[model samples]
Target: MNKILRSFTLFTALSAASVGVHAGNYWTASAQDGWIDGYVEATLLLSGNLDASGIDTDVDDGTVTLRGKVETDIDKALAQELALGVDGVIGVENMLTVFSPGDNDDAAKQRKLTDEKVATVVKTRLMVAPNVTSADIDVNSTKGVVVLQGKVKNDAEKQRATEIATKASDVEKVVNKLSVSE
Candidate 1:
């Protein structure tokens, strides 16, 4: 009876361990692509040497595919390198086009500056808004498109936040992903 009981206990433990391992893998595999995409975008956006306004990042099964326009060859390579530096990014397919600005260098620079200014203006407005809780909110802009993320107190606060961002100068659109806290 003792031998039988010990064998049964061991079997149960082994079965549980196997299930845990498989479950962990299943979740990790499913969620990894989205996480990698976000990481790569953040990495490219924060890179001072690269203008990521026109760059689109996509991830599939640990591979990052970069699409869109870059100012120069160096910028294209830098974008790829930044994406590859992200954790869980096993490979990068650089499909970035080198844009020839001709005499439009000044225009290109102005666009980049505008994107930065748009984000700053939106953030400042949120901070001073009486009804909005700006502490938990994050702001990002690219080519006049503003992305608002983070938590808000309620639905009213979320709508108010979006309205504030939309009113900011040079913001062509606002993508609100603010979650209401319970």
Candidate 2:
């Protein structure tokens, strides 16, 4: 009885600790995540052996994205339902795809190239954007292609800036480093 009680206490303590670590707006871009602690816990439980241990869910904004590996379709469904039930998750975009147990490098490489292409396209699009002045938009590139940094009027403008910067081009990815106020 003592051993069981001790184990339960430990589990509770660890769960609380995980939530404490992810209580900031630094994880994602939406505003709803700040109030959804249970969502984070649900995701952690459903991750099974999938390794998203570092995946932060403390995004002060509402945007919550959950990524991990699941062996069975049932597990996937449960995780999705739990994620959707979370307070701040307006949408749950499944990027998990499927992961075969064996070694796979093709998908990884493709992701790199796609990210680069997105960056390139986003850069080109932003350069010619209607209200955007490219001179102020600092763009950076890695294997992923583009990362935008600067300030914009609002989220709409920021999104537009990202869109113009990441249009269908050679770019593989576009990182919106842009900031917004009102």
Candidate 3:
């Protein structure tokens, strides 16, 4: 039983999905190889692809959790497969809105000078841009780095979004999470 418990704990720790970036105490995501965050960020950006079907993904360490809704079961299956294909993703969870309730008012906001209003203003700036689409993306203001995700038509669109995101006054760095369609 002790061995089983240990294994299960390891699985739980290693297999975290994007839904909850960490099991508890979400304080700046202080985990090693923080590169996992980058991989997760990249996956979310790519998911915006027209081929990606717009499944909002979350990740902690290497554990990726997905949310939002897709059009079909095939879409869900494809989403899971895509995430698994990524090099650093350790796990994938699709808690997406196969049939979702309206957007949840509850969200975590940490270490940001910009409030939701400012963030929205920034997002609106990007959304209005003809080239870059912000759907199926997660925008969090943690420590001044504006992380972007979603699918793009090509590298040009991805690069465009990164430039737009950096336009914000306090945005220190823009992490590109856009993915390309193969």
Candidate 4:
């Protein structure tokens, strides 16, 4: 009976230790995943062809997986490359699908190009403006409509951003979604 009791106690202790180890590993993995998600997001945002809001990223043990829809295969490939380039990323599994093919019409292509140009110009204007940190602002353009989404220092900063976006060539509308700092 004593031997049996010793054996059962050993088993219980070992099992508890195993559970603790597993919990520790789980927390470590969770933190790593959060960091990887943020890194992937920043990478996607830095890519000119990719819209970060449209992509979802998951990370497990230094392996980054991308799951989302992009406008073209090139954008998918670019996302994979960007994720792979992250410092701690050991591999990238790209499962992104192209949701829309390129418009075959010349007019549509021109319009898309123009919208991109206008957004870029507006972003540049904000970058050069006094007291405006362009990095805090997100600019997106579609069909000649420029959308500004971000937080600014004050009401003046928000109005300045709107003015800069409005002055961009070919911008038909400015949707200012900027909020003042609290």
What are the TM-scores, per candidate, against the unseen true structure?
0.43, 0.31, 0.37, 0.52
**Model 4 lDDT tens row, 93-134:** 888888876644567656665665566557756866797867
* Candidate 4 segments exceeding 4 Å error: 100-182
Error of 3 at 76 (Å): 40
Evaluated at residue 73, the lDDT of candidate 4 is 55
Residue 122 in candidate 4 has what lDDT?
Answer: 72
- 31-62 in candidate 3: lDDT tens per residue? 52255544444443444321344556566766
User: Candidate 3, residue 58: CA error in Å?
Assistant: 38
Q: Whose lDDT is greatest here?
A: 1
RMSD of every prediction: 10.7, 15.3, 18.3, 10.9
Worst 10 residues of 4 by lDDT: 102-111
Q: What's the C-alpha lDDT at position 161 in model 3?
A: 77
Q: Is candidate 1 or candidate 3 better by TM-score?
A: 1
Q: How many steric clashes does model 2 contain?
A: 29
Best by TM-score: 4
